[model samples]
Target chain A: MNDDDRTAMKKRVQRLVYMAAGGRISEADLGRYDTDLRQIGLDSLGYLNLLEGLERTFGVAIDLDHEEDHSFLHTIDNIVRYLVAQGGEAV
Target chain B: MNGDPTRGPIQDALTDCLGRHRGRRAVVGSEALSYDELGGRIHAAAGWLRGVWLEGGAGGRAPRHVGFCLGNRPEYVILYFAVLYAGDLPLLLDANFNTGEIESIRSDCGLDALVIEPAKAARLEAPGKGDQVPFADDVVLLPLSRPGAPPFEPRPATQVCRFTSGTTGRPKCLEFSGHAVVSAARNWVLGTGMTGEDRTLCLAALSNGLAFNTSLLSSFLAGGELHFLKGAPLTRPVARRIAESGITRLVAFPTLYRNFVAPGGPDRSAMAGLKHAISAGAPLWPDVREEFRARYGLDISDYYGIAETGPCTFEREADHHSGLGRPLPGAEIRIAPGPEDPDGPEETGEVLVRTASMASGYLNHPGLFEQRLDADGFYHSGDRGRLVDGRLHLVGRTQDHINVAGRKIDPTEIVAVVSALDGVADAVAFPDEDLNREALVHLVVVAASPELTRAAVAAACRSRLASYKVPGRISFVAEIPRTGIGKPRIAVLREQLNASAGA
Candidate 1:
């Protein structure tokens, strides 16, 4: 994907993370794309909601068992890379 | 008899169960274990536990308190049984408990040893933490040196203990007898029509009462296979497990059911083999139930159970979708009339329950559990519900405790944590729903200074309390409206907050 497209996907992923957070983490705290979502209080329940949002919004089904490496979900940039790699484009 | 003279009723029953289904699969997770293999593993682990305690000079003492602080897995099951078989009290603790909570439990209820993950043991800063003995790949037994006797003691009949969330970071430990635990399992097996061929996929934590009552001993009593998923209870993976494993029963909470009905969820064929989808912990939403039924052609049975009372009710008829089912075998429900109730035939009152599987009492807080019981031995369930056509229909809880995703959290705990922070004048925490209709703890704080932000308050909560106890939503307010009696007027405050947000 192009640089601009990549930036757009990261923004979209950030927005989804905020929505899925359910107010557990402040939007200001989630601004950095490289920050670990878990470190900022994104708990297990938040991750469950985030997976649902990813599937509903981008149609990306994350079978956690199949993924040997879970770093793709660790940061917004990583999630953007995975989504783009899976042919998910900015709507 | 399994050749053990000191075996209690629970151990004997479990030994008999294993013998009856010797070659059958017992627990399935990352690996599967047959009944015979499981028995052998439990025996070996128990012997190792005996040796460890004996080496620690605790052989002749009272039953050692062995706390389980791990998640649901095959090893967890084996170790729990091992602790029991070694003639020690198994204290099942929530795996999500923070270091502070564990320390509090260690202080309140004497912990002789803890079966926990190696990583957690490394970080734990308990006062009496001793040598760590590795049990499984990720599990270890970390022995603790008891400084002195605990303030309170378990009853002689008590064999196991579980916790309920309490105020100010102290969880109340409820004691249960081996007979009570066995009664709950047997009744569950009989009431739910569990058979030898049934395969159960349990998504709830084994420490929680929902899974403890339904999945743990009951699955073995019925000679069924108990399965545990390794990771998060997402929709696709859960559905795949059910379909691939031919799982007949799904014991989980309501959030999981809601996910199955959401857009892009697994298809109906994925759950074709699921015969019983039991939802507990929190109440299942009506819309989610209807949607799931419409989509999957299966009704999610809304299970009604109390922390003090084991399995209370189960809906036998799939067509009967309203109310929390009839009482299970060996359980009775009584709805006492409220003082303000009319003389109508059907009156909604406080739910009182008497079950053969009732807890003995709370070990930490003495006389607290007994204070809730009446002359008839019925424990007054703080819930307000009525009996409709022999089914229990809950309206709301009379207490102020907030139920967030089935875990009851004391709002005072949240308010106390926030109030202790600098620049915080007053605060009130209450049960609130997010945009997705999920239950969350909403902490509304009246900041003394403009510099005190939501992030500051959230960070304080994260550091001090357990993750589930942390506030989901933090909002700043000018002042908190209180009644003349110094009680928070939550309804009025909610209206004001809603109006201000709209403005």
Candidate 2:
């Protein structure tokens, strides 16, 4: 993936996460760049919805392992890396 | 609480009352369910279910146990009654139950079918879980495999089978007779002064024992509209719902009350026609209770009841001085000493209660109900409370089970999940409160493998247990302190976590 694509993917991921947690989690509750959603008071139900949203948004099957690892979902950098690795080359 | 009007089956009463009040509104939200509309939806759902069973070549004699996972929605009420109306036992499963947990319930409770949301249905990868059959617009039904051929024995008296909350990892299914369930609702209406004119907004899940016993039956039987709030139970939404729905009674746990009263906003008018707020399944902190009273000018009624037994006590006055209310007329209570102590009934001990509305038995486990339901017919509540001036003041639980908000987390469930990982020599899970005084699972482990980490355990648990059961904090310890009989001393572990968190 190109630099522009990677950055765009990261932004889309962030937006989708926000959309999934629309009413339940607040943006202010999310912590520093590396903080996980669990640390931000996002309950398990939030993660489930986030996973579903990501799947629907990116058309990718993401699992719980990515949710737990900091290098996968806890930060934008991790999420970008995951999306790129999941063959995000098209378009 | 004392009057037993020899009520008929709840499904019958609901149908009759709904027919009588066809023009009246039953549930109001984005859309409304008039009694006539609600009855149509229930009939449609029941007809669909009956047709599915008939197509599957199921005999009319066999009444299957049908499980469903649903959130706060108008369809929940419809589907629940529809299942009963179709001669199947409505089994309410938690929406958070993972695939493995669902399978375990199927095997243990002989669950024949499961209706869950499509997204949830995708998560369940159980073998032979049939192709999704659309049960409702929001949820789908998947047939589960139950091998036990129980010779088509019908429990004519049992209306619904709800799982009870306990610290034990093994779930126990409690069967409530139609008479018992109806009586329980009528008693609450009689005891709490719930009138047909009242409008109730329930914040808790319909499957929750608190809501099932108090709100569902009492509201409908009293001819009140039971409003449901979707999404999280945060303060603003709850306040907004109360205002919009003109909710006179707000049924929820204590933590929500704390959040609502924390801010200096929301006057009596903000809650629209709200007259009363009910809190149960956990203790209402004194300061929070006092703050609510001072700000809202309304007393928070504290309710006390057991899952096995029906409504036990209720305190109408907010300033009961932390005292629980007296028992209802028919419901009897005995405060006996702990099993270890040789105390008499006069002294404060375990709260043993026997009511006409007590559960018939644990349908899942053959002999388990007998163990809790004493020979004298009183089910031991496992809670320690003292009756003072004819009012009950709860001391605490005799066991160290963690009650997080209203959800009970079995420490053993956590231990089992964590220990299932590849390299943990020993592990202990306990409940600890954060600065907010809300409960979180805290775990300590003696890792034999250097590769084992908190993230690994949490990830594994996410796949196995519900997210709430996952540990908020995990630490490596040398060894867990235990009693001579090999019981882990959880209180010491709680103290250690408190000290470390403070640092």
Candidate 3:
């Protein structure tokens, strides 16, 4: 992923972590926020909401077939890795 | 078609829009929209849909089934009525159905278009990619919601399709027609003695029958405001919304009522204005039914109907009969005069009904459609019931009935007995074929309290029922997995039993 793509992905993830927390966690805790995915308080619905939020923010269509392949979406790291591997290949 | 019976169905309902009617709250989420506002929205939605079809691009290609994949929103209400005005069938989809299932349904039904909640639309696998009728977040806005729209005639035989709760194995789509919708709404209105003055509190999701037809459409037809509960922890909030909204009537399934009446009941002040309460979807135990009545001073009107057929039968307000009441107007009830006659009434066999409110058939599956509706037009309900003293008392599902030693025993009777036991919260009894001679297996979920042993459950079943009818084996569970409507997942329970047996 390019520097801008990486920046966008990071920002998207941060926004997602906040939205999924649903006021349970504050913005001030963003620096100390757990990027372990589970500690971010993203439940299944929250995870889904995050995906939708990312799609809307990036203005990119996510190929559902790829995102749900399980080799992806296990963690935020895997998602970023998948994105890098795709190299802007429409997902 | 544009005359009395057609317009009359919704005209009187629209009449309640005038200020003379009593103010009662129906839906509670972001803001409680008044009856005037709700009615105005319905009117405006109808008009907007007409304008879209007439002037804009929704073009007239023989009005097809319009799918509504929306959640509990004011826009959903507007869209529902808009579809009605368009003379199109509104195929209601559950908000909880996974993307795969939802897509399957959209394709299966060949939905002309879909109206999704703007908020929920994004979460869909592909929102804008599919044939979507995108409405704004403020789709329920006032000026957009006018009633004076050009009349369009709905196809006389058009029906709405829904997937049957497929505990029997594969889910089959069931169809219900415009005639059925009107008839069911009218039956409920008559059954409950609902008036313009009676506002309704709907605790169930807009997708389920209890809330969908009975509360939403029925209330609209009866000139009653339908108040919706926003989320879980229903009792307190629903009760508060009802009191605040002046909702005189409440309709829900047994499980929902059970949740309310469980430990510390709903705040008395929250439900003081409520007069009528009804239960359906699952059998309400006599004790629980009585308890709700004693607590609320409102008889829990027992309702009986399946998704295949809309609201078919309801308890008469005049006499609170224990049995599922007689068939509603324009509905026929048959006891299935077969070779076998049970011990109850003269012609009591299986409860078969032919109703105007009955669905045409499963969507796209003509084989299932034909299988469900016989040559005589009677829908074989697959439910065992008896017509005693002219009222039908549902025994249980015919599929779940056990044939043990030349005797037929319904598992409902066994489950009922088990459910009555101390510490037992819920129970499901099914015939275990893996066991010899088809012995009934009972799975019990006990409340958090004194531990309930299998022996205790067996003993309780033995005391209440005959030895053969008693469960052959018993299993304890933390909680029985239930459907959204609160019916026990008997098939799932059987699967778990089989897995354990294999182990």
Best-fitting candidate, scored by lDDT: 1
lDDT of 2 by residue, B1-503 (tens): 11221123877778777867767778865578888888899888877888877643223455678887877678788878887777677888777666666666677767778877887777778876777888666578777776665432324577777775433345667788888888888888888888878888887777777888778867877877888865556565667778777789999887678766754345656764777788887778888888888777777888788878878888765556567788865588888787655553457788889987888887766667778866798888888888887788787777667777567777887887788789999999877654456566777898989999766776777666666676665678877889999998888877776687599
Q: What is the lDDT of residue B465 in candidate 3?
A: 52
TM-score head-to-head 1 vs 2, winner: 1
Tens-digit per-residue lDDT, A1-91, candidate 3: 5777676676566765566434323355455323455433333334544455444444444455334255455456566665566553323
> Model 2's DockQ?
0.08
- Which 10 successive residues of model 3 chain B have the least lDDT summed? B141-150
Docking class of 3: incorrect
Question: Positional deviation of B115 in candidate 3, in angstroms?
Answer: 2.7
Off by over 4 Å in 3: A1-91, B1-40, B46-60, B126-156, B166-171, B267-269, B317-321, B337-348, B374-376, B400-503
TM-score of chain A of each: 0.91, 0.69, 0.57
> Which residue pairs of candidate 1 clash?
none
Q: True interface contacts reproduced by each model, as a fraction?
A: 0.53, 0.07, 0.00
lDDT of each: 0.88, 0.72, 0.59
Candidate 1 vs candidate 3, TM-score winner: 1
TM-score of 1: 0.95
Tens-place lDDT per residue, model 1, B1-503, is: 12332377788889999999999999999989999999999988888888886644224557889999998899998988887888788999999999889888888999999999898999988887898999888799999988888888898788789999999999999999889999999999999899999999999999999999999999999999999998778888899899999999999988889889987788999899989999998888899999999999999988789999998999999999789899999999999887754653467888999999999999999999999999999999989889988999998887889898889999998888899999999999999987767789989999888889877788799889999988888877788899999998999899998999899
Which regions of candidate 2 fall more than 4 Å away from where they truly are?
A1-41, A44-91, B1-8, B55-59, B145-156, B165-169, B339-346, B495-503
Candidate 1: CAPRI quality band: medium
